[model samples]
Target: MPTPGFPPGTLDSEGDPIWLTELASDDPNHTLHVVQGLEPAEALEALGAKPRLFRPCVLPEVKPDEWTSLPRAALALDSGDSAALLAGRIGAWTFVYDDAGHTLPHDDTILLSADGRTAASSLYTINADASLSYAVNGEQLAHLNVDDLDLDEELPGLPAELRAAFEAAGVFEIEDEDLEPGEADYAICMRVVCALAGLTGTLDDLRRIPLTVTPFG
Candidate 1:
């Protein structure tokens, strides 16, 4: 019973994305943040997106090719002071992707925005350091390092049930035995965080859909 748009065999045999037994992804190193109660434009702006780099020419009838089209993923702004990002909404969640910025949108200015929206930022670095952090109503919640899933005490304002859920999901059982660990754990972290944020649609949906591309350099 894999979620309909999700690739077949992605979920565990039990059909749970949170406890995925195997996950093979080509694009493993990226930053994705899903914010609650924000539209794509608002989320990007709050996350420090600069003004849209509108295409210079207006072709009224011709379909814009990839060269002229808004990029589905980060392009030139992967380094320096800014990052290339695309933000889009799926249900109540707005998902933002940063090509190389592992800490994108986790900035307090965005997560702790005066507008009061919250977000869950998930990062999977090339070094296999995976983490998931939540921002709620201007407060930074526990930032869980997937490799070290240890919570000695209850995190303030974090739902007790969510903590229990992580425990029950065996997220604490992750080990560093293989050549590249945390890949599966990264998927688990993303699914769990997105689920908690009430984000609908598959990860592929976010990657493929038409989103607002913002150049932040």
Candidate 2:
């Protein structure tokens, strides 16, 4: 006498099957016992026909403090500012990194590779006195207000080892005289970018590929 559409394993009160029509006016709680074996979706569908017998329940709203935190995240910024808000989690700690200044509020757009393995960054800044300065990674790489080659031209007298390192690292082209605000900012940005690029490349090469083996045997 059970409902025709009800799947196997459905039971009845008093251990006796009850006709589907008999459940039309029966209490939902009672009918639910008979259809307990049905899949959740099917059970819901079957019970839906009797609205008065069953109603969907709503969950309580969750508070901000109740939500779990993510491991890696970043801040987004609007145009016009030279900087972007930065926030994320590393290990179990959260951090925020922002810039100083207003006019050119470090509004920079950062782009990362498809796998999140690489990133490119840039930003512009207007100092406290309205001087335009820009930086990347922390080093002041460039300043827009000054231009002179005196410092770079003086590199000939520098120690050979120091000069060689600068040349090899492409740092030799930056002259001390060109160390204006804008240039300083550019230099800083370049250093950070280069270092990050090198580190990423080295890590990826080491981690993703197998190392060659040399044998005395």
Candidate 3:
């Protein structure tokens, strides 16, 4: 039998999900990231003695379901000098990586954009089938090959184009054992973002249109 998977909900001490790679170092280099549930004062404290403060701006909306979007309130903290310390201390948890290169676990919605003209949000949440639902930009685009997605339920309304894209992105797997949703969903979302946004999924691309990541408490 394929090696047993890490117990469900398992995470490293840093709060990084078991499936995600940790940052090589805590040094900041303008990479996109998110810190869940830090108050302004606490965030400021995390920033250090001095941190460039941008006027508070509402964070991007996270659609937990098709009809509801959670509007997160946040203060924009400029990198000023470096965001490493700020990133490390601002929250109980942090979901960050190089670029659109992350699979947010638990209930995190990270917003990404290419040129501000178009955007996509990768949402990872548990589905009714006990499998993870990885929806892009809150759009419920399903694949016709339900087996590839490990979908136990039917999705009569799945769009053909999305199915085609998933195939093109090599989302289908022939594993002998069950696989965690992160195994395919993260890479699939990366490819889908490229297909729909017309931009290579990279840190530079996101820098051009920085993410407005809002964390829920």
Candidate 4:
């Protein structure tokens, strides 16, 4: 629940806005949302949101010992950052997208059902370096290395049209010769999939009615 009269847009060390309120899955089995920015407050509002639309949630965590750990599916500040401390329970499959510097919050994120037909997509341009990625029935639908890709090759393995669509988004570049994309590398792939499937809805839709963000958080 939201704390009333909370004006949004508080900034953090990286200059990303702080999220005072949170969005969560209505079903415990589907309660996973991946917020793109360092703090997702701006990401939430850019989608035309007001508070109290969702249950506040933090990524669930676990303690195995004196040490702490996060699941591999949790969102990371960067691919190399060591903070999986916030692994969530959207299940084994994960959904990936970007806030694109908080420019298109609603279009920037998505949650899909097991069937892959029902989905919620925010309308926004993904970050230049962000990858679009998702899963269906625990099957990963995304590949890596947009630039190194051949239409049918393992580099991307996307259908030609989808691959072309992602290519238009600008591949995340790298100087390393042998770098393989990690989980975050798939955001752009998922973005193109959303556009192709017409899985998008207006941000206003979320404010007026209840919706579910699925797959993984």
Candidates' C-alpha lDDT: 0.50, 0.23, 0.29, 0.29
Every model: Cα RMSD to truth? 7.5, 31.0, 14.6, 15.1
Please give the lDDT score at residue 164 for candidate 1: 41
Per-residue lDDT, model 1, residue 185, is 44
Candidate 1: clashing residue pairs, number: 0
The TM-score of candidate 3 is 0.29
**Model 1 misses residue 171 by how many Å?**
5.1
Give the runs in model 2 whose Cα sits over 4 Å from its true position. Answer: 1-73, 80-82, 85-146, 150-152, 156-165, 171-217
Error of 3 at 62 (Å): 25
- Model 2: lowest-lDDT 10 consecutive positions: 27-36
lDDT of 2 by residue, 48-139 (tens): 22223222212112212211111001111222323222122222222122222111222221111112222223222232121122323333
Worst 10 residues of 3 by lDDT: 110-119
Q: Could you give me the TM-score of model 4 versus the true structure?
A: 0.27
Q: lDDT winner between 1 and 2, please give it.
A: 1
User: Which digits, one per residue and each the tens of the lDDT, describe model 4 over residues 1-217?
Assistant: 1111112332212211122011211111111124322133332333333333323323334322222212212233332332222111122222222222222222333323233322222222222232334333324455344344443345366645445544443333233434353312323333344333322222222234322211111
Q: Cα miss at 142, model 1 (Å)?
A: 1.5
Residue-wise C-alpha lDDT for candidate 1, range 1-217, written one tens digit per residue:
2133234443543333521111112333556677768777776667666556522221122213322222322343222334456566667667765645534545632463345766677676668677777766776666777666534443344566345434333322234434132133444555555555454344344445456665554
TM-score of each: 0.61, 0.21, 0.29, 0.27
Evaluate model 1: give its lDDT.
Answer: 0.50
